[model samples]
Every structure is written in C-alpha cells, then in structure tokens.
Target chain A: MTLQDYLPCLYALLACAGFAVMFEIKKPMFILLASATGMVSWLVFLLLHDIGSEVARYFLATMVAALFAETFARLMKAPATIFLVIGIVPLVPGGGLYYAMDALIGGNYALFAERGLDTAAFAAAIAAGVSVVTSIVRMAMTGRMNRRERETKKEE
Target chain B: MRAKQVERCLNFCCETGRQLIKNGAEIYRVEEAAKRMLSAFGYSDAEVFAIPSCIIINIHDGERNFTKNVRILRTGSNFDRLDSLNALSRKVAAKELSIEAAEAELHEIMGRKGYPAWISYLGYGFAAFFFTLFWGGHALDAAIAFFCGLLVKAAMGQMVRLKANVFFIHICASMLLVTVPVLLTALGVHIIHTDKIVIGAIMLLVPGIAITNVMRDVIIGDFITAVSKLAEVLIIALAIAIGIAIPFGILRALTGVM
Candidate 1:
C-alpha cells in the first residue's frame, strides 16, 4: 500500500488528541502517549483489513488499545478509562449508528435492521475485546498480590 | 471506633465513591476504592456496591448496622479529576492520610475546574476536522466540520448552562450539527460532502465508549450496572438519531430533497 493508506492513522491520532483535550487529560506527556495508542490500534486495524473480517478487526484493534491503556494506567497510576476512552474514539462506529437511524427514519426496516445489527455487533466485538483484556489484567494482578501475601505469611 | 467516628468514616467513604462515580470511574473501581478506604480505616467488614447512578456502603461495627447510599444524578467524564481521585484513594488506603486530610483533598478535587470553554470548543473543532479526514473526507469537508464541531460545543455549553435535559441537549446539538453541513452544501459549497461532515461531527454526541465500557461491568459481574449503562447508551444513541433525522425531515418538507 502507498503512503496514502497510512494517512488515516495520522488523522486518528490527531482526533484522539482532540478528544483527550475534551476529556480534560492534564498532562501533555500522557495525552501524547494515549493518543499514540489510538494511532497504533488504527494502524493495526488497517493492516489487517484485507485479511480479517470486520468484527475480528474491530475486536483485535480494541484488544490492542485496551492492552495499551492497561499498561499506561499501571505505569502512570491513573485510571485506564482515560486512555481507552480517547484511544477508541476513531474506531467507534458513528457512521453505522447514524446510518441505522437514517434507515429507520426513512421507513426502510430492512436497511435499519442490517445497519443496526452491524453496529451492535461491532460494538459488541469492541466490548468483548476490552473485557477480555481487562479480565486478564485483573487476574494477573490478583495472582501477584496473592503470591506476595503468601510469601509474607511464610516468612512470618 | 465510636459511633460518631464510624458515621464520619462512612460518610467519607460514601463521598469518595460518589466522587469516583461522578467523575467517570468504572463501577468496579468505585466499589474497590471505597472498600479499600473502608478497610484502611479499620472497618474491614464493610461492603460497597455501586452502579452508574448510585453507590451503597454498608458497615456492621458490632453494635449496629450503618449504611449510606449516595445518589449520583449525573456523571461527567473528567479524567484529570479521576486521576487525582484515584491517587487520593490510594494514599488513604495506605494510611498515608487521615480522615481530615483526605476530606480536605476530596473537597479540593470536587472543586477542581476543567479547562476553559474555548479550549474544549477548539478541541471539538479540531477533533471533528481530523475525524472527517480520517473518514476520507476532502479538505473542504474537514474545514467545514471544524466549524460545525465548534458550533456544536458552544451550543451544548449554552444548553448545559440552562440546565436542559441531556437528551434534549444532544438532540439540539446534533440538529445543529447536520443543519450546518446541509445548509452549506445547499448554499453552493459544491466541494463539501454533508455525509462526511455529519459523520465526523456526530462523534461528539455518540455513546460508543459507554457501550464498550458497559460490557466490562457485565464481565465484572455487575449486571445491574451493565444493564443500566447499556440502557443509557441506547437512549443517547436514539436521541442522536432523532436529532439527525429532524434536519433531513425539515429539508425534505421545505424543498423536497435532502
């Protein structure tokens, strides 16, 4: 692919930075890092566009974003939602939601059903991706804590 | 601890949860933070439950059962406040701050102000501009979307100041979002695509992130929160759709084309 194909990732990064501003993220370093996650995930989505199905691409992209958010949250000692919310903005299916509504308003039930379900599926895919990664992170954290506690108890 | 001290600690914990929820902390985080603070205060048996709009804390300190419920009417996404709040809770959990200090810090966090309105408006404008290009819009469409984004933010700010309903505010903002692009296209802005402009500007109102996070609640076994948050997202989406349709409906009636 030509350089033109990568432009969307750049735009996604800038859009995420704008969202980061609106979300009131204070630190410039955190904003840049968070927005960079968006760019990276969008790039991942685009790279797999041809080979992967629509739902799979969104799911995998969201997983990457969630992973980045989790890593950043741990390092920065901030809430992961800050990064996840901004990073996933460009991936949100606004067009699908709008088209579904447009179809419903225009009295096209078939199109409405198609677009609405497509949007829901995509949203579900993203949700599943986030949930899976968050669950893994939570489990890993708990395991580490439990191991530490056990070691301390043994020493005592 | 005395009953009065227990009561005060409960209040502090409840207030912390309220702040967390109000500033857009996840349901699990709110519950966990509240529990940690309660335990740190030597009330390990305390139980905390929180949904999107409410938090309930219960403690049985030998003699009596004490419970406090905080009703959160609205939630706003302010990551700055959330970050500080999280840090404050961590300090409190580590016993680094006493009740008085923690309360003072909570007060400070509660009173913290966001960025000026103009900066957020610029943020909206630039976000829309970039999103339009991300969606493959021409430079002209992106330019128009920037202004539409600014106008949307300004309109929403005014409506919020007037205490209008959230759904009404979105409907109005979205109607304004569509009207600008369509009006521009009608007024010989041949280079602009209304669809691209609308798609980009609509991001400001969409609940996509909420829907994504709601699933986390479900995964965390907070079914009540998940369902309630999902309902809220659906309602917001419907409001945005209705907002979008109004302009097209008006245009169709006025000139028979949209």
Candidate 2:
C-alpha cells in the first residue's frame, strides 16, 4: 500500500533483469516476463512471510514462481527452466548461506548451526515446492493428451 | 540399403543431445529431444540416456543398430543458445527440418555469440546493487556492492580466460567480495554496511542453476545426476565460504578489523 512496500518488488525486477542479462537471455520479451515473474514471486514471499511460517514462505513463493515459469514456457514455446532459473533468483538463500559461513568462520558454533539449518531448510523447501508443482503439471498434461488420444481412437 | 541414412540421422540426433546437455539442459529434456528427433527421422526405436556430463544414444533401423556416446567436458548457461537449440529440436521433430539442415542450424546456433563481456559486467553490478537494496541496505551500501560486483565479474572473466579451475574461480571471486567491502569500511566510508554489501555481491556467485537443476533432475528420477549436482553445489558453497573466511580471519588477526 505504501512506497516502502513496493521497493522490494522494484528491486526484484531490476535484479531479475540483471540476471537475465548474465544468463545471456536473447529474447527481450522473455527477459521482461522473467523479471515480472521474479517481482510477483518475491512480492508473494514478502506477503506470506509476514503471515506464515518461515518454511512456508519460501515453499509457496517457489511454487508460485514455478507456476508462472511453466505458464510462460507454454505460452512462449520455450523451456520452463529458462524462466524458472531467473524467476527463483529472489528466493535463493544467498544471504542465509553467507551468514552461516560467516558464523562458522567466526567460531560461533550455535549461530553457525542455526544459520546453516535455516539455509538448508529454505533450499529444501524451494526444491519441494518446484517438484510438487512441476509433477502435477506434468501429470495433467499427459492425462489430457491421453484423453484426446482415446477420443480420437473412438471416433476412428 | 538405408543404413547410411539412418547412421547420419542418428549422429545428428546425438549431437543435438550433446549440445543441449552442454548448454545446461536437464537430462530428461535432452533425452526427450533426442528421441523425438530420432522418431521423426523414422527411427522409432531410438534410446537416449543423458547425464550432466555425457550422452549415450542408440538408434535401431530394422536389423541394423547404431550407438554413439558423446562426452561433454564443459557446460555453461547461455539461454539464447538453449532457446535456439530447443527450437531446432522441435523443428526436427515436426519433420520441418532434414538431418543436414538441422546440422547446419545446430552449427549456427553453437557459433552464435552471447552478450559482450561488458554487458555481463554491468549485469553483475546491477544485480549486486539491487540485491543490496532488497536486503534492506541503504543507497551507500548498494553503491559499494555494485562496484564489488563489477570487480568480481571482471575477476571471474579473467580467471575463465586463464583456464583456472571452477572452484578456484569461485574462491577468488568470493574473496574479492568480502575484501572490497571491508576495505571500503576501513577507509572510513561509514555509510556502507559491510555485511549487506558482501551478501549482495556474493549473490553473483551463488549456484542458482545447480540447485534448480538438482531438484529437477531428482524429481525426474535421475538420481545420479541429482546427487552429482548436489555434490557440485556443496563444493562451490564450500569454496565460497573458505574464500570469504580466510580474508576475514586474516584481517581480524592482523588489525582487529571486520
């Protein structure tokens, strides 16, 4: 609702566009979609983190991001990984991993363990979210194909 | 007979798989593309097995069977190349492109250049700058992180040109990531938060591709690839941690500086 609330989304868009360049994404349209995907997913994560558990925040954010990527992939006729990689950039546990390593090097065992576990959990949650959605999408696609095939056979 | 024609087609198909895998395509997708191309060329009994580093393909034409193994020694992300290759495979599968034509197209795709080094450097700088802001850092920290990101990108480009090991490249990049921010702080630039800047700049080196691929490969039941990729992710993480830790430890031991 406020300007401050929109800052993170703007940052996500810029960061994702930067990532699209780093990945050498050639298509301008795909770059825009990827950045939009990143912004929407990061906004969702921000909103969820305010009201949900830490793990659910990452899980739901990734799932929604993958959903966007898959939809875009279908519409664009490109591989979903293209969108998924850049879209999920905002959710990667880069900071947590850094803090974990920093703590370990600083000889703070407790802080190291805490940050390490948190990073691992976030990583796992992201993986789970992506896997679940992708699998469901795959199943639905194949099921639709099979039904069409059966209908054509019956008509023949 | 038609054995020679089948041989050429199978060769083209396997090469396509190799290119896809080399460009960081998932194992399942590579296999699917290869198989689809083979079937389009009238070899429906083709089998393709693609791993992160290699692809093995077998094509059967009646009583004659041909098998080829391609080992991919290097892989990187170039989405442009990936998109073109994916399009090429789809065209081949749809019977729109003959084997020879597809081969030429593949060559063209492989030879296409990515964005120049300067553009990638700019990308790194912007990514760090925005990530700093996203992580709640002020304008000063974001500016410092942007410079650090440019430095890291340039250093990485130099390391790649020198044919340095990947782990060494990551270690060196991360070392620069930590050192630059701390050096700035030591120079009395009090507005920059060293922690936020380092975190932001380090995002440039994080293994986002590896982590995503690991999950995809595992879900698709390619455990070998998933486990290997997981190992790779951990190694890169370790290298980065070591890189960041050593400099901080040295700085602390010598001058009690953060």
Tens-digit lDDT string for candidate 2 (B220-257): 78899999899989999989988888778887787774
Q: Write the per-residue lDDT of candidate 1 for residues B87-163, one digit (tens) a residue.
A: 99999999999999999999998898898978998899999999999998999899989999998989988897898
lDDT of 2 at B233: 92
What TM-score does chain A of each model score against the native chain A? 0.95, 0.96
DockQ of each: 0.75, 0.81
Q: Model 2: what is its DockQ? A: 0.81
**Model 1: residues with Cα > 4 Å off, grouped in runs:** A104-108
Q: What is the lDDT of residue B219 in candidate 1?
A: 74
Position B72, candidate 2: lDDT = 85
